[model samples]
Target: MDNLATTWVGATAKQISRAVRRGDTTATQVVADHLEQIAISDPALTAFRVVRGGEAIVEAEKVDDQEDLANLPLAGVPVAVKENTAVAGLPTWHGSAAARTAVAEEDHEVVRRLRGAGAVVVGVTRMPEMGLWATTDGADGPTRNPWSLDRTPGGSSGGSAAAVAAGLVPIAQGNDGLGSIRIPAACCGLVGLKPGRDVIPCDLGVDNWLGLAENGILATTVADAALGFSVLAGRSPAKLTPPDRLRVGVALRSPVQGVRADEPNRDAVATAAKLLGQAGHDTVTAEPPYTTGVRIAGLLTWFAAAYREAQASGLDLKTLQPRTRRHVRLGKMAWNRGWVRQEQRDAWRAKSLAFFEEKNIDVLLTPALATTPPPADGHSGGSWRHNLIENIRYAPYAGPWNIAGLPAIVVPIGLRPDGLPVGVQFVGKPDSELLLLSIAGVLEVANPWTRHAFV
Candidate 1:
């Protein structure tokens, strides 16, 4: 029953909610169709590490009967959860052999919210061992791009990004700590957003290092991303909607170290800016003091926490994927600080606040990554580093927002010359996600991206 394929396939969150209200579709059909798609594609793409056929059907059956579920915001929508997030009765493998047999006894907050909203969780997507390197399936040796089975899907949330981009589901969950969500979104050609720290309670992630990570989503459309953000945020009922006026910031310098902007990425950002301008908002292109040194410092801080966690968990650092282990090990080292690291962090915060104060800009815009898509397959030792350093340049655009505990959004402006998609991120101040979402809704109407990259 291709409830998702032919039915409101491109339908926004509002449309899906309405369809469920009208009983034109039931949560069971939506979950079933997506489950069917996963059954077919998982073997070829290896996008998902685990598929929950029985659990999804059971939840959907409940939605099918309950009138309350039909009226719920996400009544019949089907979604994928990243494996790292716990789902009661499912294995919460942080993508490692250690947790291979460790099924979660309770649902993670993210999963709880999704179920509470009546969304059917059809499956849990793949991740690198504990989300170490952007190693989506490099750990399991299965993760690859749906577009080109040979390319990498961008780590951590790569499975989620790939699942949605492939249209297996309209949207899927992703966790971003150091560009995990955005990186996969960029590579898979989907919309991804990282909310401000504390915007969503991360019960398992106890890191004090602000920038190393946060949770977000990958969706076929910006609205799907918005709905996912809305539900997961657990915003107090007092905040019903995002504000109307949002302050937006534009970055003049690249956040990656020693790297200049790539043509496709720049073109994409320019396209998004033009859309922002047409939408009748003030825009500026000044260097926002966002820097790579700050990135290194933040990574170190994150590694300190991750290392402590690894030691406590008694997980073998060596058993982890090489890239993830290498980076996490590097995180245990000394800080690469001076005037630059501290200054970037401080100045960016001030710049963010002033951007809103002076220009009434509440959100910032930039590329998730500075390059076009890469091969879906994992890269080798040194070549991987060079590729990551060059191709994944400017990931900081999304990172700074996470550090500031601000929310960020990305939707495709359009695709590049090579037929791969290029995207720009919209970042909102802390708790201003509702406003950022409304802004995204405006752009969505202006330029809608149909998940047309693959057949």
Candidate 2:
């Protein structure tokens, strides 16, 4: 229908679903439009490990064939699943060939929920091997940021973020263990939400990184993010309401001892504070209690997660990338010493929750990242020390929240001096996912950033 919108490539999930449900366009056309966009653009970003072109079209046709679309929340919208997750009939490519698993007989629970909500899985996006590093790259190639090709789309959810930033998909599914989803969202100028622990079922590899990881959504808009979150969490889609006046705690301190937010990231926090103030929310300078013990426990758990996944998958550690192999070895040592304990994480969770009550705040605000994203090149082949240093220096702000198992979101504030996107993180008490989304929506309306990268 040339009379209709020329293309649905950049449409939000809500817009696309409404159009398809209203008979303005067919699901097949929408899926075809997105597939064409992916074919034209994904080669540059290397965002996907697989594109289900034929299968996606067939699924879209099935959606159109259904007699009633009244109950579908994401009717006809295209989505990308992170490569680490299972999609039926496709081998799970855990970032590289060496880490690839056999074809999944059935979809993961999250994928099943998305399909049930009428979303089509167009492809599975790439990640770092075993999702060990913050930067996304592998033997195939690096997943570059859509904002700047030279800079990284921070990972291990990098590919998912890139696809959404470039409008290949309106929303992509990602899981955050140690800031995987939020880091990429920050780098690519999107809204990324990591729900509090166990809010959504996370049957990810070998115990979901010892319960630090949770399945989440990354999207160009807060409404789409909330829609995706609802689908994954198996709840009815709810409209996001503007939140009541909140007492927000603003902190510029980096969780890592040696790393601090660069000037651009700090400015991003300041910008967010001003927006909150303009929205009738109070802001105060308050820092979460990120103690030395919490930092050490989080690092050990991160290393142990690598070891657990590799061992449980029966992967030959020597065949993995050099940096990953070193990480696995350290994980084994940590496991042997019993350093990665549940009690340590639980302690941090208790302390983090107390900070809100002790300070009399409803939400906590912090820079999404410590500095700009690292370079996209050569990280997959770099030495273990270099990769570790680069990752920690730029992304030290996200892991502590994961350790605490609190709901956190990253919302883009503005662009950096060097033209990369910058964002700020908001952490709320348990069961505050919707509250976090409401705040993000306020930011989106108050300071509307570019919806898509000008790729």
**Top candidate (lDDT):** 2
What's the TM-score of every candidate structure? 0.86, 0.98
Query: How does candidate 2 score on lDDT?
Result: 0.93
Clashes of 2: 0
Error of model 2, residue 46, in angstroms: 0.5
lDDT of 1 by residue, 211-276 (tens): 446777788766667777777886422233333444466764566566665788887777777777
- Runs in model 2 deviating more than 4 A are 1-6
Off by over 4 Å in 1: 1-17, 99-101, 208-212, 235-247, 291-293, 335-360, 380-396, 452-455
What lDDT score belongs to each candidate, Candidate 1 first? 0.67, 0.93
